[model samples]
Target: PVGGELASHQWRTEHFNNPWLLGAAVLVRDETAINYNWGYNAPAPGVAAENFSVRWTGSVYFGLNTEYTFYATSDDGVRVWIDGGLLIDRWQDQSATTVSAKRYLTEGTHPVIVEYYDRTGPAVIQFWWEPGAPPSPPSVQPFEIIVDDQDPGFQKAGPTSSWYFRSVGYKGHTYWTYNSDAQLYNSAKWFPQLPQAGNYQVYAFVPKQRADTKNARYRIYHSGQEHSYSIDQSIYFDKWVSLGTYYFAANSTEYVYLDDITGEPYASKKIGFDAVKFVSTAQPGPAVTPAPPPVTPVTPTPTCSIAPILGFGQVWNTNPTVRQRLGCPTQAEISTWSAEETFIGGYMFWRGDLRLIYAVYNNGTWQSFVDNWDEGQMESDPAIVPPAGRYQPKRGFGKVWREQAGVRDKLSWATAEERGLQASWQAYNGGLMLWTQTLGVFVLYNDGTWIQP
Candidate 1:
């Protein structure tokens, strides 16, 4: 479609600066493209100049499985979703900023959504897409099956004394029980549904908090035999502790079991049962890819090297490739978000050449992107893919963000990126997503209900 459907563009006013599309649309019309600079003017006849939102939904046809980067530049906040997956999410009050995310799409039509909100400034928003490198052909991809504590394959037996604890567990949650004798009061089992009989490497996830049992025992029922192993959960935190490879048939009878019996004086230590993973060791088939059709070649833009900065010594010194990707420090780190009106907490770093940026809280957890500049970025290798154009939380906040699929699906994809913040907290879709040492990662919903998982 050359022009968008008139019914797809919707404009609605939000008196409270709430970016969500809670009310009915006040203005609905067609738009050729999402390129606008309202410049302190109202977006539409009835829409307000500030504290208003617009949503554009339509189907986009993709011609290849190649990578495409969607760019969204807006003032205030903006979010974009492709095929219902959130790519760029920078739902915060700021100047005109551009954020982008890359997605590999097949040759077909995919649903695209763009949501924007202007708080109180020169409204500016432009959205477009650029094709990037094509995806590699399927190769010897590792075969792995992960069964989280919340998965259907996981079961808890014995006493109901085991409790759910929110931490940096495998899938952001774990079941814990006080250590006891081998009598077994609480036990958890993970049954694997394999595709075919083969050798698999099994591993267990140990969380960082509330897990202190030194002699946490595990039992693997496979090949009609029982294999026992003891683990010291206290030594490793938020890590996958391997339990060696084993042979298993594709049946429900074989399982991995763990009990709260470590013989370490009852109630003295906590035993954590998180998630289990099974990895196939089978060799992959041969790789085959047809030749791509020849197309007109264009000269690539040359990228320059980044010069070091005094303040970014820590991150710059560690990652050598950051210099190449980001040409130079455009300016010193500046305040992004603040705790008090005067106390700077969130800081941002800009690059001189491309539309890339890096941000960090006072804790030094960094976030980088080719366009988006919120949240966390941890990889150091240049070859290691950057967010490419996404916002991912870090540490505990990341744990909760990864676990809450339903919340993210509702708030991130279905609505605008107008997450508000209040008093040392970040808000999202009428819910609070903040982290603390005492409370860990939690979400406080508008209904006064709290969830930590």
Candidate 2:
């Protein structure tokens, strides 16, 4: 602890302006998550960052046993140690600069300590670590692709592989649960190529089939990474089941696999494979800012409107008993996704913390898509989170926001609305979490399901 005294000496200043090594004395300290940006001020208001000294000690958890490099970027003198050994020892006055040291450790916890001193001027400190070596050259190019029913990119396996992803009605065999059926094999694999690099969402045709397999396993591989997914082929039917979105480097060899060897205990059941559809998702692209026009642009009044919601709209706006219970829309109604196959327009209404989405039935009645106990959102939640909308693009299966895209050529009627719906969504993964004034948090899934998570 005697080193704490040297912290105040100019010889031990962050810049190391003096060649002499002065002793340091640790005076006061605080804990942090290693992310801080304080400019032209002390770490604490009264304490001067100049000649201020701090020491941070903690344990870093590593999931995998691998070599890691601890990096520290600071504007003053700093020292880092792992275990009982020193990795970096530049305890001298310095301007904004970064220094790092590598350490070999097992897949577990390791002790770490960071000592820093701010001599003067702006103060900045940051620390971070990642698996494997530091970031290097870019690897493969990500890809965007679409494999349709008729597209040659589609492939099947196993002796029992059906002709394609089809429902029973295609052949009028109502006996089949989903009207159509596709077959699968153990370790069955399909390879589809992409035209370029980017992130893409993989959706599988899931038609309800009571007799279908309960634990059909599927895996999607992209950009040197793969994720496993399992489905109860009986529950979700007549819908595009998402296998999750992933990034893929441009390559014709990338594949999606359906394997029978799942770790779970199940029978030797027959799995179905409608078709795997891929649609381009968000990918990093260059950004450019353009000069503003000489004249000020006029703003247009935003129009609020909902697509024709059939019977549901009439009751949502007129029903007496329902209005007394759930209340009516606080603001104007918003258009929501309508099913292309059913030709039903959906409506979203918000009355304070009471939020509801409505769809119609054959008997001209309206009902909520999902039902459950309640939770509310926090006051800090975004005013509007993108609602689930279904759109089927002509080129691919189409896009469906979980509770959350770009405008495309054609869309299934379900989520049709005026431009700019995507701009309001704050969810990164299609699931929106809203903070309500009363309830803590309410979640809306991309498939139009609600839960109080």
Candidate 3:
């Protein structure tokens, strides 16, 4: 058999091991062969030897129609696809290891893509292929099972009207549809029946026709965990795309799922529902124990604690109105309330029994009820009319005036309606009282000193 080399451009990056080949590339070069051993050193001037990634894409020529096995070896993660069919998918961090997958193809040129990343330590990667079936011993061939869309093992759900069938390619027939706007509106599941428990590489067949969705979502339920993957069906046709390998028990709980929801625009593309193949990599038999199931992560429930208060004691002991409205402190006192005030020492309190919240300002120990329900109505209500020569507080001023008896006595009577000084508010009379979010509520006396009521 004649041999041919691939004309490829390798895109390399110094960033951390990224299986997706994302981010900018640090080096790009056309190489005649896919072979490299940049051990403990950068492959290029700017690229890092470890914690880096590389992607090679090009076309390979096959002189004859036959079975060909593609091989890849890497220290960490790696994935390979030929003519849009993912053959090798060991995309994970691991020591130096090699993996290969064989596929039959006609005489022609086919596109190939290889992606690799090194996490740490010595870095290495190589790719090559031989024209022949993978050398297997005289032992029984590994067990392999494929569940077609028409098979009883293949279950489907959705409106019957949306389901359409086609007869062609690998499985003889497959189900396909236009992309759906609704989530998971159409779905198919492939449940395989294994004779024994073991690890298996799963693959989904993307048919030649009626499959055009760029984002086809597949889920594999194995060993109490569901792994998700998004495949572009438009690039693959009449080929089994690897969905990764997993440990599965010979039971009904493990299966493969495909849905119409691909986050694509409404009815813009076609989606194909076809067959799923499970190739057993582990030894088959009752004597082979199933791999331990992955540990389901446990999320810790959140908890909160209220620290003891020391600064609010002074204000609580001094003001009876604050003590009555605020009750016991819920949180500790802090210096300089927020970013606005210059005063030190303030605290927030809550009456759990009454469901009332209160706050006292540090400047003058002014009390404030933090009631959300009645605050809007109380502040916007009409002002009370003045009695004879005495004037009533206006707008928000009236609401505050009516609530505090001490304000009425100290201010005598309002001479005018509340006016705004930027974001602050004030009313005139025997004494001027200003209200601002930062100062809370306080009376500015003739001597310039303010008092909290």
User: Whose TM-score is greatest here?
Assistant: 3
Write model 1 residue lDDT over 1-453, tens digit each, in one string.
Answer: 123122333322223234565476777775657888999998877778888888776555666645566788899898775533345778889998878665544454555667888888799988888765665543444697888899999999875645656666876788887888657688899998888776567788999987898767777777564555566789988998766556677788999998888766678998888999887754243111111112221211223122333324343344333222223332233322221110022222233222222232221122222332234653222332323233443322333223433222211211111121221233222222333333233332222222233
Q: Which has the better lDDT: candidate 1, or candidate 2?
A: 1
| Whole-model lDDT values for every prediction | 0.54, 0.42, 0.56
Error of 3 at 103 (Å): 35
Query: What's the C-alpha lDDT at position 426 in model 2?
Result: 16
Q: Which residue pairs show collisions in model 1?
A: 100-389, 101-389, 306-327
Flag the better candidate by TM-score, 1 or 3.
3
Q: Every model's Cα RMSD, please?
A: 17.3, 23.7, 30.9
Deviation (Å) of 234 in candidate 1: 0.4
What lDDT score is found at residue 204 in candidate 3? Answer: 89
- Residue 271 lDDT in candidate 3: 86
Candidate 3 lDDT over residue span 141-219, tens digit each: 5878989888899999889999888896465898887777666678888999977777777888999999998767788
| Per-residue error (Å), model 2, residue 189 | 3.2
TM-scores of the models, in the given order? Answer: 0.32, 0.33, 0.35
Which stretches of candidate 3 lie above 4 Å from their native place? 1-141, 282-453
